[model samples]
Target: MDPAVLREDMVDGLESDAKGVLHDETVAVAMRDVPRHEFLEDDRTAYADRELEVLGTRVLAPSTVARLLQPLDLEDGHDVLLVGAGVGYTAAVVAEIVGETNVHAVDISRPLVIEARQNLARAGYGGVLVDCRDGANGFPEYAPFDRILLEAAAVDPPRALLEQLTDSGRIVFPCGTQRQRLEAVSADSEREAFAAVSFDPLLVEGEQSGAVERNRMTREDREHATRRAESRRGWEQEWIEWEESVGPQ
Candidate 1:
């Protein structure tokens, strides 16, 4: 019952003809090398091809990880950004493929971000940077990433994330609401849709888990929205007179 052997069997299951979720041997090898147990609370179930909940976030199933990563077609030394770091398992797997120093991750939940950072460090991917930020804004400091992976679902790719990609960079995420499909888009706006999948919607500052309140009418939420609105231009801006609309109502 060695963890390494469990990893091998996990990869084998993913690669089997019946599943065929994984095709890239490079990615497969990386999955084998990453110790998934370090990121989850239950070490016994870490290698299982099932999702586990941690810190109110569902750690993506192994097949889902493979499905998301295979389309990225990652390369070593590539600068990669993961929008929803979750428990940091996906980021660790990505660090394995693209080199630890080249990986960056962001999450809206501060608790999740703290947990992810600790998990990554424990897994020996201490070089991967995990920060607390709204996934919609992305990690702008590390702009022009070679690839971006969004673990949350959105009606469309976040404009900020798309803008942060390198000229040839590609982003993969689940697109839609009630129904969703895994899709990837390149810098040029060309898109490809893959399997149907469900993911939690991307969250903003006030909507994150353990926030003071879910209502966006709070002072903090309004101020955050106002700041974001002020920075937006043209059709991108939602026509809301913040003070008049949400104040004392």
Candidate 2:
């Protein structure tokens, strides 16, 4: 069998599986549309196969990609963020769901970001922000995002990221350690708080979310705020007493 045609056939079969499990037809099209082989370069035969390792350096499961797309329930036009763009293959898929104008991707690897930038273009997903930098802090310039996806495993939830999301946006990632879980964090617009948070036992170690350090400062912040409030109250009382005698305005 020719590898090219075989690849297409395999993808066709994968598409069968996708259609059954995936509820969204648009997601199904994007799954079938983007040539999985282009994103995965080393699998001479993965053009149709479900899994591929890019340049023999990174491994990505086509099923995993498909699964992520399902729960996302992404609308056609949305402002989305991806933390670990890798070679940008997943980002490209996300770009398809969200469209090019509203997709933004970030990563810590320089070469990977460059590769992703090019791959996104090849995938016909232009205007995405694929940048090489620490994904730990999250992208602030594009704040208040609607959807944020963390691609890597984390030891904690990335705080900088949580703060950047629009109130009511969704953040999905794997969290926890020793026993990791896939979790989703959702904000509640009505209450101005997080309404839904689901944590599932992780399949792998959690990705470092940079929340550890911020969490460590929690006690200090509380103590500092308490002291400041007490001081302000004391000053306000003294000023009021003085004004009563001096005739206040």
Candidate 3:
């Protein structure tokens, strides 16, 4: 409820490190423009002060969402399809990042989608399209997006999702069943090839139960990483360094 703690916890926690800032300008504007607490449940309204609510099946942590967006390199002129709309909190933040006309969100829960649409409307965001549908599969009717982001963790990237990307499009999400991870996927339609970078999934205490333990990349995924690394013979040194920064396998 207190704006002071909200800024300190979510905003400050996210911005404390330079590496944490994804769309800095967008975050700044959203921080000032949107009323995030309004969308949370009655009891957890103030949790926005330092907490995130488990809205339906999706759990939205302010800091986690902010961290997720960091590597996206999103900007204007990009049409983004967001999976897991959540109570529209992530959508609102994204709506602030990418213009409304360029954003659409889909969720599996009907009630959540209704609430998402209304919440965005109440926030005066006209660009985001909230649909009640499966998030694992992107909105195909809109086909071919410049960018795709999944808010939920999956063991692997869904097949249908890749089919919807415009050439050279990029996707960022956490993947892996037991050993969940955050990965960046970039596709080259001409070659039908996609390269991804994955890190240990963010596993926190008191979160969802039944989640599996983190594992090294699958044998295939590992080989892909190795082959991709080898393909860049000249850049091996740098690529290796980058891989190290992502943390050990």
Candidate 4:
């Protein structure tokens, strides 16, 4: 099948299976125009509305991407900051909605950042900036973005990202560890839960590096470590206190 046909089919699926996740025409058009196959290593299942693991990170499903972006209210010429730009598929979609020149994406994994850059460039979106850095610390050089989308799950919206938004800017991210809720946060620090989603936690400084080290461990040991890491709780209260104390100024 032609890639265009596959893309349209994917869009059709998104519209039907989206469950109100894709209400904006701009977002729909962007999703249709951006070639998801380019960002993915495998083009055969590119349109399958399922998450595919790439570059040691999972690229979110199209439905999940729509859920994360629908609330941001993106517009042409809007500046967007995309956190956790795994392979740049979401960023490419955003670049199509907002101009490529106006979109900046960051990832904690340097290799992923490089791959994302190559993928975006190959897909004719070289203008979209892909940076290798800790996503928790928002890209300050381009402070004050109109929309910020965090593709990874976090306990709460990053304090730095909130501060980097324009007064009316909005951010969407998944909150919680085991039971995650997709949340949209306003510049004023108010948050609203929209949908439930399962996403990997945002990698912090040194976590990505640590993941590289864990490759040497046995499979069973790695599985055991992962379970232990996921079982820890109480991030919600900690996030609330942190928000109250340092709130968005």
Candidate 5:
């Protein structure tokens, strides 16, 4: 099937089932134009609504990406920062909406960042900057972003990212370790929380060593283990306790 047709099918599904999460026409066009297959090893599943693991990191589902982006109200010429550039698919989509030169993406995993860079270039979005760094600290060299999108889950907007936002900028991220909620926060500190989502917690430098080990496990087994872990009472309690101890203030 033509990739463009498949992309339109995907966007149509998102619009139909997203429950208003993907109402932006500009975002829809961006989603359609960006070649999602170029960013994944398996093009067969490029149009699937489910998330896929790329280079050991989970690339968020298209609907999830749409939900996170919708509240940001992206516009042309806006300077956007994308944290957790898993495979650059999301960044490419954003770049299409807000000009390639205006998008910057960062990931802590060097391999992922390199691959993302290649993927972005292959998709003709080479102008979007893809950097390998601890994304917790927003790229300060390009201070004051008009919009920030963190693909990974965080307990709160990192102080550094919040500081880097323009006075009227907005940021969207998934909060909570276990029971995550998509949140959009403005420079003025106003926040809006949306539907629950399950996302891999954002890891910082020196914290992703175990990710390699986990990826080494058989894919089916790994997925089963992940499902079990998310459902385990002890795991939930641990996150609750940790949140109580050190969650965002």
Candidate 6:
């Protein structure tokens, strides 16, 4: 039960014809190198192809992670941004492929961000950047990432994330709300769907864990009302009396 042997078996299973979730040699090697146990509390199940919940966020299973990353076509020295850095496992795997300094991750939950940072550092990827920011907003401070991977599901790729992609950059995300598909989109707006996937919806600022407002729709409604109030016109603000206007004139 050596961790290295476990890692090797994990990648091998993913590459096997029955699963075929992992085919890219680069990604396969990276998965083998990154110690998944460093990111999980139970070392016994570290290499298992199953999801686990960490800090109220669901950590993607190994096969799911492979499916998510295989579409990115990651390259050495590529600047990558990972949205929804749950347990930092995916970020660590990516760092192994693209160097530690090139990986940047953002999460809406502050506690998860802190945990991911600590886990990543312990995993020897201390150079990777883990920040607490709403995944939809993305990490704009480091704009123009060469590759962006959104671990959560959204009906459409967030506008901010798309705007932050380099001209040749590609973003891989689970696209949709009710039903999801693993898809990749280029900065030029071309898209390609890979497979059906189920993922938690992307969290907004007020919907994240430990936020005062846990209801995303309610916050959205409040913001919509604010926009409506700001856009109120002459007649839209209050009811106008046609009779009073004529009489006054």
Please provide, for model 4 over 69-138, each residue's C-alpha lDDT reduced to its tens digit, 9 standing for 90 to 100.
8888888989999998788888998889889999999998888999899999999999999998889899
Sort all candidates by TM-score, best to worst: 6, 1, 4, 5, 3, 2
lDDT, candidate 2, equals: 0.63
lDDT per residue, candidate 5, 1-249, as tens digits? 888888999899888854556888988999989899898766659888898886677888888888878877999999999998888898998998889999999988888888999999999999999888889898999989999998888888999999999999999999889789989999999999987888887776666644444433445576898898877885565546765667698
The regions of model 2 sitting more than 4 angstroms off are 1-12, 15-23, 42-44, 48-52, 55-57, 189-249
In order, candidate lDDTs are 0.90, 0.63, 0.65, 0.85, 0.86, 0.90
Residue by residue across 1-249, what tens digits does model 2's lDDT show?
455564555446656745444445676667656655566555464553344444323445555565555555688777888887766777777777778778888865556677788877776776788976667677898877888877655655577878888876877776554454455677552211211222222211122233234433555777898897787854566556765666857
Residue-level lDDT tens digits of model 1 in 26-137: 8899999999999886766999999888888888899999999988999999999999888999999999988999999998889999999999999999999998878889
Clashes of 3: 6
Over all chains combined, what TM-score does candidate 3 have? 0.66
| Candidate 2 TM-score versus the reference | 0.66
Question: Global lDDT for candidate 4?
Answer: 0.85
lDDT of 3 by residue, 52-169 (tens): 4454354465656666666566777788888877778777777777788788898766667778888888778856899866565678889788888877666656778888887878
User: What TM-score, computed on C-alpha atoms, does each candidate reach?
Assistant: 0.86, 0.66, 0.66, 0.82, 0.81, 0.91
Per-residue error for 242 in candidate 3, Å, reads 59
Q: How far is candidate 4 from the true structure (C-alpha RMSD, Å)?
A: 10.4
Which candidate gets the maximum TM-score versus the true structure? 6
Q: Which consecutive 10 residues in model 1 have the weakest lDDT in total?
A: 213-222
RMSD of each: 7.4, 8.4, 14.2, 10.4, 11.0, 2.8
